[model samples]
Target chain A: MSALLQLTGVTAFYGAIQALKGVDLVVNKGEIVTLIGSNGAGKSTLMMTICGNPRARNGQIVYDGEDITRLPTFEIMRRGLAQSPEGRRIFPRMSVHENLLMGAYGRPPAEASQDMEQVFTLFPRLKERMAQRGGTLSGGEQQMLAIGRALMSRPRLLLLDEPSLGLAPLVVKLIFGAIRELNRTTGLTVLLVEQNAFQALRLAHRGYVLVNGAITMAGPGAELLARPEIRAAYLEGAH
Target chain B: MVRDAGLSALVALGLFSSMIGVRMTQGDDGMTLTGRGGALAAVVAAVFVGRLIMLAWRARRPAGTPSPKRVDAGLSRIGRYVAPVFLIAAIALPLYGGRYFLDTGILVLTYIMLGWGLSIVVGLAGLLDLGYVAFYAVGAYSYALLSTTYHLGFWTTLPIAGVLAAIWGIILGFPVLRLRGDYLAIVTLAFGEIIRVVLLNWTSLTGGPNGITDIPRPTLFGLKFNASGDADTFATYFGLDYSVTQRFVFLYYVILGLALLTNWVSLRLRRLPLGRAWEALREDEIACRALGINVTITKLTAFAIGAMFGGFAGAFFATRQAFISPESFNFAESAMVLAIVVLGGMGSQLGVALAALVMIGGSELFRDFAEYRMLIFGIGLVVMMVVRPRGLVSGRTPSIFLGKRKDIAADLVAQGRG
Candidate 1:
């Protein structure tokens, strides 16, 4: 499959300290590519850089035949990219339905409602808590709402940052299962960042291991999962 | 708990000693403690005793147990009827009430308009604008200058002034597009000062400190509210004897209509996508951008629309006074309007109107208090903040709801994150 997103020599910084150092990565169309890393490993930094928040100090980020290296975050989102950011930053004051509607802020109303139905189908709990305040939701439900909100944008490339963080084993399984199902059925391209290395690698088609602001390994997900060094470093005792 | 009460007593002592201990008299022996010292000590002792009682009460409650929920059914049930009843009373006031009450009503309505205008920026959009009075100034000056130079009527100048202020809002909005919270507040405050300084310096255009005078009052169609004018006066046209109260009553109704319009438009806009965008931006701006909302456009619209309303109020103020000056639009005016929004509870239209009534009417009632008016007002504000830190009406109903509409408690909503 042709590449849906390609980042070359991407360098990013926060103040004087560098967060990403010439990181190279690619996500092919109709594939789930996971980036596995520990905390403080520049995974979120790369995600934010791709969205042009603290933009890449150097390098090229091409998405769907267009250079999006310097596009503003909202502009990047308007170009069919969406991120379910870390910490599930749902608008606390907004109801669950309003938060979902916000995800379709840039789309036509009719199509947005259609996407909303798809999201509701994926997370029925969200439908049950439709009128509840976002802040009042439980941790698992809030994560589902965050994912549902991102899905409402109908993004061509969905970038998820630590989707399974702090979730129960069953909820994590459900989230990862949904991600895999989304890719399989709709050919939705996903670039997932996860601390749960074993589960992420199992779900993705290809995987990249990032350490200390640089990629240490890249290969097919099965090959990386089988590596003795990767097992010792990341997958030790992980379910 | 004993130590806490002692600390509170000490603090109260310091506060009361400086603020209420001594009085300056007109006699040769100017400074006199008199009986005020005893009163101050009594007040301090009362506060200390109150704190001790509160501490004792808290100690009696078991730890780690949730407080019992207070039933809010009666209050909300009453709230459903409050608005219609208030509207009827306001409409009937001129028929029975005398001239003084009508004047106070006009004053209260003006503040309500200003409070609503500021609410869009501070409450909905989460942009802290301490320079809102700048837009008010722009509107007043636009009306003052346009009417004086071109002899435009109040009705004609009203919209032009609003547009002019909106343009200024855009102008101010552009430079501070990236600032948020405290930084945004400081910049807006400076912008307000800049406008006032310009008005003070631009002597020829704004008439300097002397201000523009003899500006025409608003008319009812072609009829003026005066004894002698070229066209038929309001009194003559209606075939009633001329009374000064007629003008005051008319002005009161005009302001009441404007305030009601502000409330209606604000409520309508809250349900629209743009208004939802404002609340979303207020909640978390980065998430708004992630959701493909143009933050700059949202911020600009909030500022411009808010300023437009401020301009309308300013124009009305100019016509009401029949004169305009820089003194009317100042930082204190901005603070007062901002206070109304906060005290009313952010993003609640009814809260703003209630706050404006209590704050403005309370100040008006304390007019006879003279030098002590501001002191009493300060104490009232402090007590309000202590009693209800989130303002009087802390519950917020979400604009869009799927099942049944419910008011979200104030603490449930994010606080001042922007």
Candidate 2:
């Protein structure tokens, strides 16, 4: 199958400092493409760049065969690209239900309720805390809510930034299980950025290893997991 | 502790200087500096005594009072009844109130309408608009000019004035689209001053500082309130004795109806999609954009709608007085309305009205205090701020919820985050 999203030599900057330099990445349809990296390796930058926040100063971003390199962030979001941003930036004052409604802001109200039900079915914990304020949730629950809120959009492509960050082992497992289930059941295309290298590679269909601002390696998930260089650099002692 | 006392002494000195030392007079000596040494000493003594009392109080109190759980959930339970009670009392005011009370009621209602209008822009949309009086001015002038030049009645000019102010609101909203917070405030303040200056300089059109007088008063469905030989005088038509107080009562009901309409519209809009989007934008603009909300349009609609209401209040102000003047729409007027919104809990309609009654009505109550009234008002405001930093009735009920609608603690919401 053809690629769902294609990025060619995408370079992004924060003022004069370059965060993403000459990055080329692709995610095929119905596949979970994991990008594993250490701290400050441009993972979040790439995700934001795709959403046209800090717009790609050079090169192109193609999503579903359309060049969305210069579109506004809301326009990109309207085109079925949703991101559960780093640090779980949920509206703290808003309730979990309101946050979910915010996610489906671009969609029809009728379809949004159905999407909400699907999200609740995936994350039952969120359903229980539907009335709770987003800020009042635990880190793991907030992470779940962030993901669930993004899913409320029913996007064709989901960009998750550090979903496993600061989560307990069991909560991490639950989150990964949810991601896998979403991919398997709905054929959802996912571009996951993770610092938890081993679990990410094991879960992804294909994997790319990013160091500094560039991707150094790309292969099948199992092959990347087996590579000694990746094993020592990222997966070592990171069960 | 000694350093803290010294700092407090300095603050007391500064406060006394502003409050008592300097005065402006309209004489050969335009400004005068009076050395109120006794007042300064008194202020310093008061501060030191206050500090000592606070220290002693803290020392006597238990160490672990559990931080007083700033969230008074019970207060909101009581607060739910405040609006209904106040509404009932306000409706019955004309039956038993004297002329002075009725006038104060009209004044309080006008401020409440203005407060509600500003609340939409500042409180709901998170846009600090310091020059909201510009819209009020626009509305007042629109009605004033329409009535004087075109001989349009109050009813005919009301909607026209509102639309005209809304258009001006849109015009002012454009340049400030990229501005936020303090920057937005400065621009809006400048816009308000610009309107006042234009009115002052445009003598032919606006009558300059002399203002437009003898503007027609509102009639009750084409029936004049006078006993004069008009086609249908209200007193003659109804076969009642013509009393000047009847006009004041009619004006009271007119403003009460207008204020109620403002309240109803604002409360209804708060639950709509646009209002939710506004709150979202206030919370996080980037997140709002990510959610595909058009932030610019949201902000503009808030401005337009807010200005529309301000216009309605201004038109009513003109009709009530049957006169209009630039002096009536000064920066102090803007500050007064903004104070009402802030002193009322932001985003709470009931709070705004309550604040208006207290601030405006309370000022009227202290009118006998003469020059000391402002000092008392200032002290009262400081005390209120210290007691309830988030204004009275700060608890927020979420616009949308799934299960039971619990009141979100005022302390829980990050101020200026939304």
Candidate 3:
């Protein structure tokens, strides 16, 4: 399988403090790759760096076939990389439909509507709250809208940052099931960052353990889930 | 409830004590102080009564009913009818009202255009622009210079002035691209002062502090409003009396047409893709960038389009007065326009119009109050802020809605901080 996104020796910093320290990772096409890490382990930083926000201090980020390390955030996004960022930063003032339209920002209206229909099919709850402002939606519904909004872009590579951050277990299960189903049916490449290691490892085809801005272990999902170290560090005392 | 009212009255007394209670007049003795005990008592009593009424009103409401949202919706429903009635009244004003009324109408309409123009930046796009009068000055100067030097007609200079202001808007936009919130407001405020200072000092070109005079008045399709009653004059060509009121009426219609065009364009833009990008940028800049929208271009367009309208209004001001000056585009003018946008609902077009009427027309009516006009205006604004902090019409109508359309509650809509 070809690598959809390859980050080699990527480094990022917030002022003087380094967040991503020479991190190397790869996400192949048509695969669900999970990066499980504790809080402040540079998971969100890696996601933001991939989108060219803080500007990686070193290393190359190649997405699809082109190098996007030096590109602006919007330029990188225009190349079909969509991020359902941390905290589901949806447009609070806009309605759910308008928020989805914002996701399909640069696309032709006809194509956008078509993709929006596909999104609605995936998250029908969004259809019910079509006219409601995004801020008024419940947490689960907001997560669905955020993912659905990402899907509206028709992206080849979807970057999700902490989808199950503050969700109920049942809601987490529902959201994970949708992600798994999406990957299976459409061959959509996903790079999911999550603290829910057990479920992320279960849903992902492959998994990487991020420890303090560096990838310490990488292997097939079942192998990582079975490893004593990963189980102790990320999966201990949790279902 | 009485305790709360007493506490508020105490705070008001503390605030207004020095401002109202003591008066230092230029007496025979140097700055003799006098006490206005009666006025101070009246102010404190009024505050006490107003606080009591507000607390009583809140207590009267049932808990958790969301009555404010319903009231907002009702107000907006009434707002729909108000726009048409106001427009009709404006159209018919010249027929019955004398010169003073027509003049006030002209003044109010100019501000409505100015308020609407600033609304696109501060209201919709969420960019705080205290330097908006800079663009107005640009437009005014463009028309003044173009008409004086090249001998251009008002018809010719109008578009030129708008384009020039838009260009200046883009220029101002580039510097503040990374600024937000208070930083943006301060930068824009400085920009206004910079333009005024430049216009004041650039004596060779702008005529310095004395300002430009004898700027040509706008003609009606090349027909001059001359009392000579020559064949080419409006009086002779239209077979009418050459009253000065004819020119005033013509100028009135000119601003009305321009103001309507501004309103039409602003309303239409709220639906367009560029406009959507602006609202989206205002909602969340990070989300907008993630969606592949070029924020630079989005911000620049908001500025350019907003400034373009300011320019149109400025051009009108110059033509109407037949004089242009740096004094006209001061920081107070910028603050006044910003006040209209804020006092109205930021993004609501009709709210801006109503706000302009209250601010400009109400002040005109209060001209009889002489020195106390501004004091009354300040008190009214303070009361408005205390009662309705969001705005007069704060509920937002969603640009696109599905199912039964409903207005978004004011609290749900995020004001663009920058």
Candidate 4:
């Protein structure tokens, strides 16, 4: 598979501190790529910069061969890129259906509705609670709604930041299972950011280990799974 | 005639008649029209009358329906919304009331237009504006100068006023695009005060403190409303009395039409992509920027469009008054208009209009309590805010289409509240 999304030498900063330092990553078309790291490892930071949140102070992001380093988040989203932000920044005041629709703000109406059907099929729990407010939903359901909302944009690349971060085993299983099913059926390219390295690597084709602000280890999911150090730090304690 | 229809009708009629003399001092032109204060009084009065009748009728036989209590409850619920309805009716009062009254109507319409105008910026976009009156002055002065110098008619000056306001809006929008919440509010307040001060001090072009008077009034076709209607003097030849009231009423409707047009346009723009962009900006500006919505363009459009309406209202004020003064466009006007929308309910079209009506209308109602009139409004505003933090019609929504909502009342109380 050719590269669908590429981030090279990406650097970012908050008011004074540097967060990302020359991070390089790639997710090929139709592949599930994961970024596994401990807390504050710049995984989420990299995800945001790719989507133009903190903005890349340096380096480049290319989506479908077009440089998108400085493009605003909405524009990147318009070009078939969507993110289910960490902590599920779903619009809390809105209803479940409205939150889902918020994701499709860039999609054409007919296409968005079609994608809505697919999201519903992927996580049927959301369908049952569509009328409930985003704030009222349980944690697992919120994550599912977040993922579903992102997909409403009919994104060419779906970026999920910690889908299993705070979810129960069943919910984690359900979300990961849905992610795999999406890749299998739609050939969607994914860039997942997770602290739950075990589940992430298990589901991903490959992943990059972010230590501090740099990439330390990169290999196939199985290879990363075998690393004693990686196992002890994250996966061993996590479900 | 609503449920318990028979009893409520008598009460409404009683209200409708007694309220006629409520204005007391009939202006040489006629009665004063709506303002936020005036609108509130009308609401209270209407409810008092309607409730009294409702109680009597209910005691006699209650609305002859299965859920009679619900119907009565619904009447009270609706009765509470007297401000919005009274304000809407006030928009048309200038037509029949006479010249002085029509002029007051013009004032009401000016605010109605301003409230709606700012609603787009502050309400929908969730931006707090203190400088909104600056745009009003811009449009007013633009209309005044353009009219007096160019000898342009009211219709002719309107577009110029709108364009000028929009241009200023763009200029104002850019500086504050980076700001949000209280910071945005302070910046906007400063912007409005700057405009007012500039107009006050800029003696050369603005005509400064004296302000431009004798701004031409609108004409029907080419015919002026002046009595010299000798063909050259259109008013005399028409066989109708050359009453200034006619001119005032006509102008009142013109503003009404324009105000209605403003409502229609905003409603349409809201449904389009731009409107959605504004909402996104409101919810989360950072996220909106990420979605590729140019923060600058969205912010600028809101300012420009909102200012354009302010300009329209300002221009109308100039023509209707036949005089323009700097005092007319002040920070107080801005505050009053903003208070109307916020009190009405942000992003609520009907709510904003009601706010303007109550605010403007209630002030007029206190014509009897002239000494304490302002205090009444100030206190009323405070009390209203405390009682209803969201607004008078808090959390009201727009239908995707323009039709009343369907009702299969969920509870008897809900039906009554309806």
Candidate 5:
């Protein structure tokens, strides 16, 4: 598969305290890639840098043969890359539908209703609760809404940060299942970051192990799942 | 001694009236008579009768209980809408006064219009614009320069001045799009000062603080407010005396028209997609930017529109004053306008107008208080903010329809606390 995105020597910071340090990674076209790490392991930071939030102060981020490293968050978003940020940073005051519309905010503005319908098709539960304020949603429902909102942007690659975080086990399973189904049916590429490595790796085509702001290991999903270190750090303690 | 003197004076007036067998014939012509001491007598008599009726009515009602005003939510909303009109409609009263009081009323009206202009900036956008007077300055100066040097008519210069202010608004919007809150306010305040300094220093164009004088008054279809008044034309052309009240009525209606148009345009804009976006952007710029709502465009639109209104008011003010000066659009003027908005409620339309009246009218009315006037004004504002920090009209609700209320994210799952 062709590499759709390439990040090399990417370093990011927030005022003197470093979050990401010289990380190199690649995401292939039509792939579900998961970066499994603990909290504060630079997973979310890496995602933010890639999406041009804190901004990639150093390094090159090439997406679809264009350098988007220096672009503002909104411009980067317009270039077919979107993120469902950590904590499900959905617009709390807006309705679920409005939240989704916000995702496609810069999009042709005319295509919003059509894009929202697609989002609803992908996550029907969101359709049922479209009128509800985003904050009113349960943790699991909020995660779903956040993912659904990102999909409204019709991105080439959807960056999912902790989709399963803080969710119940069944909800985690359902979210992973949805991820798998979305990848297979829609052919939508995903760069997912998660603490639920076992489930994330199971859904992903490939996986990278992010340890202290750098990827320590990279391989196929099954290989990561089988590794002794991956087991010790993630799967061994879980059911 | 004062009480005794007042009773004796009143008794003298009564005897004087009785000696002449004074009578009032209620008609259109009697309207003129009412102005010359006749209305005062009638009003005093009416008040006495009204007080007696009120006392008798209270006596018939249940004793020992204070009567409530019976204000409901709907009634309160209606009161809010109508109260300003009822309170301020007495601008019509000044027709009975000399030209000086009518001029005073005109000044009050101009301030009300200015307050409405600033409301769009600080009220709707939530951008604390301290340089609003700068836009007013721009408009006035633009009109003065264009009208005198270019020899343009007042009507032609008015729209041109508004356009020029809006252009300045856009120019101002470009630099400070990234800044917010206190920093933005300080920058805007400096901008006002900068404009004033420029006008002062740039001696050629502005005439350097000496100001432009002898500016022509607005003419109505080639009929000047000179000896040939509206009534004179109507009398000769139609063989009927339109009365001098026609002039007063026309000027009153002209301002009324401007105020109404401003209200209409503002209200319409509020309902548009742009206004809602402005509110959303105000609430959270980060989210708005993230949503792909161009922050620069939103901020520029707000400044431009608000400045346009300021220009409108400024043009009106120039014509009203028939003189232009940098001193008129000083930092104090900006503060007073901002104070009006804050005291009114940032987002309220009517609140801004009422606040304007209170600030301007209070100052004029308290001219008797002299040095203590501003002291009283300052204390009243502080006390008002303490009583209602949001504003006088802050209690007003935003919309008719309600949105879904957020439920707290609490688990029904029991935890062992006991």
Candidate 6:
């Protein structure tokens, strides 16, 4: 598989403190890539860096054969990268419909409705709460709406940061299943950041283990799942 | 109930003792202090009676018959019909009311327009702008300068003034792009003061504090609303008797048209994509960026559009007064306009008009009670904040809805920090 997004020696910082320490990662076209780490290991920082916010202080980020290391967040997003950010950053006052419309902001209106339909197909609960304010949605429903909103952009590379972060096991299973199904059916490229390492490894085609802002392990999902350290460190007490 | 009333009267006595009981009057000998026992007793008695009536009213009402939320909802529901009815009364005012009433109408409409203009920035876009008067000054000065320097007519200078103010909005927008909440307000407040100071100090161009006078009034397609005897005069052209009230009536309608246009455009803009982008920006800036919206452009547009309307109102003011000065566009004007927006409930256009009517028109009625007007206004605002923190029309009708239209209660909506 050809690499859709390639990051080399990527480092990011908040003032003097470094969040990403010379990390190298690759997300191939039509492949589900998972980045697993414990809290504060720069999993989210990595995702945000690729989106050009707090940007890569030193390194190269090539997305779809174009350098986007210094591009503005909105510009990078316009280049077919959509992020369902951590904590589900939905517009609380806006309706579900308006939130979806915002995701499809720069796209053609005619195509947006069709894209929205595809998102609704993935998460039907969103359609029921279409007129409801985004803030009023339950945690799981908000997660669904966040993913649905990201899908409205018809992005080539879907970057989901901790989709199952606070959800119940069943809802987590449902969300993971949707991501896996979407990848298989549409060949949609995904770079998922997760603290739920076991579920993530089981769902992803390949996985990277991050510890202390550096990748400690990289291999196929099943191969990583079988590693003793991976099982002990991430999956020991996690269901 | 008697206990509550007694407690209220006691508190009232403590509050009003020095204010009502004691007075200082300039007599032939000098300033003299005197006691007004009767006045103090009357005030205390009035407070006692007021508390008793309030307690009785509350006791008589059934429990939860009208929740605050229900009241807010009902008010907004009635607010729907209030607009057209108010418009009819406003349009018909010149027919029945004398010059005093018409003049008050003009003042009220001016504020209504200003309130609606600032609402776009503070309400929809969620940017707290404290220097809105900068644009107003820019507009007024633009018209005054053009009319005096280039002999441009009011009709010709109006759009020019608006464009100039919008440009100033953009100018102010660029520097404060990253500032939010209190920081943004401070910078905007500084910007307003800077504009006023410039107008005050620029002796050569702006005539300094002396101000520019003889700004011409608006004419109806080159026909002047002046005394009859000349063919170009409106009275002569129409073959009607000339009356000074005719000019006042014409100015009244001019501002009415301008204010209504401001309302119409603002209403239409709310339904557009640009408008939605603004509200989204207000709701969450980070989310807006993640959604690929150019935050810079959105913020600039809100400022520009809001400033444009302020500019329109300013130009109308200059033409109506036939004079322009920095004093007219001061911090107080900005505060008054912002207060109207807040009191009207942010983002609700009709709420703004009602607020302006009460604030400006009500203030005019209280002209005789100048000393107490501001005190009463302050108390009214405090009461409003405690009773209805979200203003009169707190619920928002979603610009776009699916299945059926529903008003999002104030609790669900996020009021941006601004």
**Leading candidate by DockQ:** 3
The TM-score obtained for chain B by all candidates, in the order given, is 0.88, 0.88, 0.90, 0.74, 0.72, 0.86
Locate the minimum summed-lDDT window of 10 residues in model 5 chain B: B409-418
Candidate 3: Cα lDDT at A145: 90
Candidate 1 Cα outliers beyond 4 Å, as residue runs: B1-7, B14-40, B50-74, B403-418
Candidate lDDT scores, in order, read: 0.88, 0.87, 0.91, 0.79, 0.75, 0.91
* Candidate number with the higher TM-score (2 or 3): 3
Point out where model 6 deviates above 4 Å: B1-67, B402-418
Count of backbone clashes, every candidate in sequence: 0, 0, 1, 37, 1, 0
Give every prediction's interface RMSD. Answer: 7.6, 7.2, 7.9, 7.5, 7.5, 7.9
Model 3 regions lying over 4 Å from their true place: B4-40, B62-67, B402-418
In order of appearance, the predictions have TM-scores of: 0.92, 0.90, 0.94, 0.81, 0.73, 0.91
Report the C-alpha lDDT of model 5 over B209-228, residue by residue, as the tens digit. 89888776665664445445
Every prediction's TM-score for the first chain? 0.98, 0.98, 0.99, 0.97, 0.96, 0.99
> Candidate 6 versus the native: TM-score?
0.91
* Local accuracy of candidate 6 as per-residue lDDT tens digits, B25-112: 9999999999999999999999999889877877886654433767877887898899899999999999999999999999999999
For residues B81-156, write the lDDT of model 4, one tens digit per residue: 8646765676647545766576666667778888999999998777788899998888888888887887887888
Going through the candidates in order, their DockQ values are: 0.52, 0.42, 0.54, 0.22, 0.10, 0.46
Q: B1-418 in candidate 1: lDDT tens per residue?
A: 8889889988999998867876666667775555478878887898899899978876786654322224234444666788788889899999998888998899999999999988999899989999999998998889888888999998899989999999999999999999988999999999999999899889989988888998888888868899773348999888888889989998999899888888888889899889999999999998887788899989999999999999999999988998888888889999999999998888877778889999999899989888998888798888777555666666667787543323222322333211
* Residue pairs in collision within model 2: none
Model 3, TM vs. native: 0.94
C-alpha displacement of A79 in model 1, angstroms? 1.2
Per residue, candidate 4 scores C-alpha lDDT tens digits across A97-176 of 66666677755778876888899778767766666667779999899988898888788898898888777888798889
Off by over 4 Å in 5: A13-19, A86-101, A106-110, A117-151, A161-185, A195-203, A221-226, A231-239, B1-113, B221-223, B228-262, B271-273, B362-365, B395-418
Evaluate candidate 5 and give its CAPRI docking class based on DockQ.
Answer: incorrect
State which candidate, 2 or 6, has the greater TM-score: 6
